[model samples]
Target: MHQLNSLEKRAAIALALVFSTRMLGLFMLLPVFALYGEQLVGFSPLWIGLAIGAYGLTQAILQIPFGWLSDKIGRHKVMLLGLSLFVLGSVVAALAESVYMVTLGRVLQGAGAIAGAVLALAADLTREEQRPKVMAIIGASIGLSFAVAMVAGPLLARWAGLSGVFWFTAVLAVCAMLIVAFLVPKSVSKAPMAETLALPQSLAAMLKHGQLLRLDAGVLILHLMLTAMFVALPALLNQQHLAAERHWQVYLPVLLGSFLFMVPMMIIAMRRQQEKRYFLINVLLLVIAMLICWQATTLWGLVLALLVFFIGFNFLEASLPAMVSRVAPAGQRGSAMGIYSSSQFFGAFLGGLLGGAVAQQFGFVAIFAVLAGIGLVWLAIASTMQVPSRAQRLSLPVAVTTEQQAAALAAKLAALAGVQEVTILLADQRCYLKVSAQQFELAQAQSLVAVGNQ
Candidate 1:
């Protein structure tokens, strides 16, 4: 409940704006691209789907490496390079006359992966306690961008055409670059933050954990189902007599209604500690959406199905990061998140390939069947997940000159009352602890670390 100071608020808003700006440009094509892609030479259902998801393939491949590069170079410098690449990709897409060219442009767009760097920068700018709020702000911005893109992308494409959409994206990328240079506050500390960069050594542990793996798989499948569904959705709407230009009419209501339903369910799940239950419910809802798509005879029924799907999508979108944080070991959150993001993007790429192939051979409706099968598998995996822990992680800066000193301090802190886990990272000059808030004595722990600071 602590309020963010002016600096924290500024960093959060500026980062959120940067994130939203880039995502808005990317998502703006989701609702209309499949339809508009038809106008390209060498266009087919398969290539159209590839054009929609090719960005994810390169994004997944480069996401971690880009963040690692940011650590060696300055964050702002990395961001500048990434944004420049993005602008170049947008220009390529704008000039593309064939689906193959569009796919290549999308691949280049994904090559500029900078999400990890942006997150690292946010972590550096905020205190440990305030980082969650900053992440939440950034997360909300992404969700808002998706909703707005669904509506605005179609509208913009209606007037300007698909190429015009890419031109606008290039303009937005330039604006984001300016914001990075001027609006973002510089990090004052050179401390190595576990929340900012992933450690390669931690990769095995992060991947092997049962809970974290499940969550990671869930995200990958969630995005896979989403991208795959969209591959056919635009065409289906055509069957229902809704033109691509008018698609927003359905999306606007679906997003609004889904948000209204999603918020309450999230609150209830948190209050009742029924995260697993609600997560399973959402998975099932996705399955139901697929089934409805498979059998629906009316447009209104399809709209209703979309509402259900969004309700589940929105809830999971909000909760998945929280789930990851809860299960991740102290001091290795960045690694966990990086792996999770890779999985999610990979899902998008695979979904496009799978959906496109199925649509081309079996027909549009069969894509729904394929997605439903995937949903059921996800539901089975999710059902095995335990309820997420409510304990909070606290980071304490400590001075330690040797590995032995750090170990001794870690042992001492581990023996403290209410401390569930301790991780002392000497290189970072910090120790991370997980504890129940009600039982934790922050004053005493702060006193212990304060001596080191002095």
Candidate 2:
């Protein structure tokens, strides 16, 4: 791997902080909000579920648009604006007395859909060789924030209350805004190009791609089950043996143990050549987790089942973006990732609403059964997929001082052996290439580009 420059490392850290702040705000609410929501006046169980999912609903609607807009506007500018919106939303939620008001705050919170923009910006800013590593760093930060939030959120909720949690989120948002404004280094934004996809076309094409659809469906269903299960699981645990106050003892161990399992799986998946087999086996693990959760009884049994669930969850959560990098047509990757993200949020929304109702009526067993059914359907779809082969994620590098030179270079690179796809923008001073590993000849290709530079 090529070493990252200082600027690239700084950008990665800054971006990770921004992502973590946004995620912490959203995740902190999940552990305790729905249950307490019911105690508040005028709050129905359905409404509490809606409140839980409201951010995801709006985020799903706008993620693509925001990504497209960031392409036109400066990414940093869009990012700062989005962070400000998040702060505003947090303040609104913090002061709200009614369920409707809280729902509105959640919607506003989702309006700050700059996470995609940030990732796109990072891709734009970093070297192709370094981008994956930077992406991994940002992803790790998100996972860390989530685990910490689950354990910490309840404590803060107890100490400062949920409203206080929102207030803290608002402050974090301000910190994000400041980082975007002052800490992040400048880079050239993407100029409009013929190959760059429009919002509508991007969304439509993404939906039609069968592989991406399967992955998107899996995420939506998985999260829906997750949100809905949490809605009822704690309360159920209260009935069986453990009190709500001691729930973290269960969550902490399960989450930590799953990480232990996840590390080795990741090493094997990354190093081994059988991407298809690994992918399928991971999906099967989800099926097993669903079954375990379906039949869980003792407090320790619930923890064990969750351990299995996280094994599946962590594996899928990390792998989906890598899949997106492979499956999305090179030029439209930004918008494709945006659509993928929106689907994740929408899953959260649907899970909270539908999962709650199912559990309320038929009990938690039915909830797990429903999740298992969804996973089984996904596994069938996944099994049919021809997982993209392990190979270099193709991106072309070029240095040029003129449009004429860039056009000539682009043509020469496209004509080279192994080059399957090429996208060039003379205005942006960049090239993106997709070449198959079976056919790739990097040394010959490098010599060709070197001639263009001279």
The candidate that wins on lDDT is: 1
Q: How far off is residue 132 in model 1, in Å?
A: 1.2
- Model 1 RMSD in Å is 1.7
Q: Which pairs clash in the backbone of model 1?
A: none
Go through the candidates in order and give each one's C-alpha lDDT.
0.87, 0.76
User: Against the hidden reference, what TM-scores do the models get?
Assistant: 0.96, 0.88
Q: Over the full model, what C-alpha lDDT does candidate 2 score relative to the true structure?
A: 0.76
- Which residue segments of model 1 deviate by more than 4 Å? 447-454
- In model 2, which regions exceed 4 Å deviation? 188-202, 394-415, 423-431, 436-439, 446-454
Model 1 agreement with the true structure over 42-85: per-residue lDDT tens digits: 98878867988888998899998899998888788888898888
Clashes per candidate, residues 3 or more apart or on different chains: 0, 1
- Per-residue lDDT of candidate 2, residues 66-87 (tens digit): 7767777778888988888888
